[model samples]
Target: MSSPDRCPVVHFDHHSPEHAADPVGAYRKLRAEHPVAWTEAHGGYWVLSDYESVFEAARDDYTFSSARTSYGGEGLSVTIPKTPMHLHIPIEIDPPDFRKYRKLVNLITAPAAVERMLDMISHYTTWFIDRVIEAGEADFAEIIGVPSIVTIDWLGLPVEEWSRYSSAHRATLSAVADSPEFRQAVEVDLPYLSKQMWEVIAERRLNPADDVISFLVQQQVDDRPLTDEEVFAIVDLLISGGVGTTASLVGQTLVWLYQNPDVRLRIKDDPGLLDRAIEEFLRYFSPTQALARTVTKDVEFRGCPMRTGDRVLLAWGSANRDEAGGFENPDALDIDRWPNRHTAFGVGLHRCAGSHLGRAMARSLIGQILERMPDYEIDLDGLVPYARQGVNIGFHKIPARFTPGPRRLPRDDRSG
Candidate 1:
């Protein structure tokens, strides 16, 4: 019968350098001692550290609504200090209406549709690797980041401006809470990006094509085509969702493989194990660490009372390591670990639509690296992590040196 006034309180900052350096370790400690501790940071929010709590909360979206409006009706605030942004399409919307927007985007991001992009993913990966294969040394982030944006470019959006979009998109992800950089990106970069999307949307309206933008422009919701604002919101969702995270996964996993040569050797020796390895890496080091959900109604969860509109952070990284959550040796990285129901891509209605695309990109990038740079070794001393780490955990720089190789793909093979 613990009440909100009596529950244990902890001083935990997800963006702190200590947590950024090793979030798993932080979660391991929290889950053991204070599985549902209340934190004072970002205006006081409950942090669910154990798998059961996070999983249950995520499943019961009604109780813990994903609506960003729960905060102040400003926009989809997934973080504390609430970044000044607009609605992020389906993610910021609740069920019923949420499904409408999701259905439209899902047409392209579905597993079958994503599978069709494998060839293009391979081509993009080859294009990126070709740029660095001969240099012997390269920043893995740059190598992976550009191609990821380009892949999304092919999905719809102007390919000519992939670099600009990629830079702004990455900046938006890595920006700190209310920092100058974050403010600039939110105020400047996001609007600019949205305007670019609007241009594409306008173009698609006049001349439809076999791309996401065209589909969005023509897709009807409840017997009517989506409005301009709706189209822009969907584009915002897709662009933000498409970039950054996959690149983070590829870059982070490459660093992990380099650190653990035995695991690297095993994967290199048996390429069939790559899929499992990717899953294991995802569980071990979740890129999208935590997401915020607003309480829909007052309720008691695990002896703690929650009021409506209260914000809670679903620690996906912590849940992945929760032993009681069906994972054995939760801390250990077992590429072959079966029945691994990790929440790396989250769960319930709001599960990531671009998950399949993300996996394809990761697999493609990893395969390309292993094939072309089998002996690539990361400069451990040069590795740098992103400054802010609440939502996304990734490396800013991962410099590696490998035996030089010849380019296999032609430069003109850019378009899939």
Candidate 2:
């Protein structure tokens, strides 16, 4: 499998453990060793990791485009085709077209809106902890994970059925991701999830309330309300995006803290320092790993040639960790890391809309957990079974045990 001209390695299989264990390692190697590498695996595509190359891909929609079409008029399976849910989401669109939807999304997810939900956020954080804090140890996923479903579902989703939707979400990504097994899993679950969303959308329409669903059920766009299908499309994105991604961040970040007591101590002593720490965590431990795009025109990026019709995975995890990539130390978690531009929520036109809410939920949940029960380290073994996979990097399980009695956290101060 000869790659395009001026390329380096020809990775034979995309699902190799080497690719799985440390995805960024492969990308870094590509950036350093093969700035314009091509992989013949998974129906063929290109990997662009050079800092300059990715930046170009993000900005130049004409050369490195977001639309799922190619100037070459070829149907390359390089990128996953957009779904119905994408139509209502400006996140999947580009520029002016994306703005119409993004403005509404931003309005609802604005920082001020986050402040308004502080009481609910605080209450949930405390409520979840109060349930399992006494047990001395509990699975953060099940306790907090299940609760997220409840909170989000009340926001106008049928989240009580997460036991079902969670499986569906995992399966759909698994299908398109690294394995044939996951693809089979998707076959059995995706339709069910879609159907459930349809049913719930219908129910919410007939009977509206003060929740987010009602807000949408009657929301007007230029004096006309959204269609049921459009409403479901947007809500579906939230269903998959909101709860699952936050759970992953909370679980993974906890595990990271558990491994580094020094870091944990830093959080324990200066609770206020948590806000900055959470930002750095999102940068270093970006939950969303990669987003794919179909190249729409011929272009040369980072000095490597790109074809008109090809698939490119903007491996964010790799970009965030790149040593030469103009951010702070990509490898370490510096609580005071400022001017951080890691693309955890992505860059350019498709930036994540739910990010404010995501950060708020994660910060509040993690802060409250350590605030009340500071000495518990996480359990990684149990998470193996239910941890879902997708572009969003996440964990399936996190078990933490309190070190018994009045857990001591770092006080108002600690040396950085």
Candidate 3:
């Protein structure tokens, strides 16, 4: 033994029950005390906590190389294929290969392109709220899960499949992102995901539409039309990212808002405040947590030596709460927070593709909720906020009670 005081490496078995059952207290020590500590577990990976380190790690891909595709300046972990036919499309390819899929993604997630989906998004937003209003009480996970579920609607697919996909995605995430057990399980479900995406791709190929799937099927990269497997793989990546991250983030947002009424009232008073609040929430909660990368060569992060071929982990979620050079009271919910340089969606060439839309959807919901249910209060006893030890961070359940507020009743006696 090297003795307790000199032990530099801290290993975390994130998949352990303790990780989910209780994390804040478990994580607080690491977040504050060990900002750039290395980990002995998870195949001897490093754990980055401070915002500067995490952001630096995310931005410097050469040092913290991604396992997948890189966007304008961000990247995600590559989904390791257990079997040969497991599939590695947009997300598994790095750099040049990553860029090819990124171009197609940029076109679909563009402001104008997303703008076209606004009406549908808003319609579903209102409808989502109405579902809760009629019930008088609801699990925000199921009711306000529109922005994510409806995103599939944008793909010209049945939103009804959300539950199944959600289940499979969560299972797969747990298997691959959390522990070896989940990885083994993921091997079984991944092929099924490919089949599902193939069905959608085939439908879009026969009848091309303005939808993303259709655009993908008709797209050509490197003078070659993307293979059906490639298209399906990309689709699977997009679907999983949109639904999983958004759902968890939204669910976490609701619970946080309910817990902090002062922040809630600010948005309720000035609905426009959500423009900033949405960003702040993403910064504060940072539901996606950490992502992994491989070290291409020996490098040092802010004086810390990192070796080549090392498995490094970027704790994006915890970084947002670092005491030094990070957020002030990073743990608190501040709707008016600015200069909030939190790396929630990540940084570098793989920054989140649908970040703008995620903010828009969040803003839209905050607007609707404040207007309709200003007096809404979450059931603290029933507030089963999401607690995950792996891939994403968010709510599994957020029970809320919607109470009608004082408002003028519309006069419709003779209205046509």
| Candidate with best TM-score | 1
List the candidate 3 regions with Cα displacement exceeding 4 Å: 1-7, 21-27, 68-89, 174-193, 299-308, 404-416
Tens digit of per-residue lDDT, candidate 2, span 53-99: 66667776555556535432333222333222233355445566656
TM-score of each: 0.94, 0.84, 0.84
lDDT of 1 at 357: 87
lDDT of each: 0.81, 0.64, 0.67
TM-score of 3: 0.84
Q: What is residue 333's positional error in candidate 3, in angstroms?
A: 1.9
lDDT assessment of candidate 3: 0.67
Q: What residue runs in model 2 are displaced by over 4 Å at the alpha carbon?
A: 1-6, 12-15, 68-88, 144-147, 174-189, 221-223, 379-390, 403-416
lDDT of 3 at 119: 74
- Give stretches of model 1 more than 4 Å off: 1-6, 70-73, 178-180, 411-416
Tens digit of lDDT per residue, candidate 3, span 1-416? Answer: 22232235675645456767655555677776676776654445666777777777777766666654231123235321111223445545568677988888888787887787777777777766765575567777776567656677777665766555665565565443445545544565556655766787898899887677888888899999988887777776676677777667677777777777887887788887877888788877776777777777767766667776666667777777775645688667777778787788887788888887777777777777778877777776776544445557665667778874432223231110
RMSD of 1: 2.4
- Report the poorest 10 consecutive residues by lDDT, candidate 2: 407-416
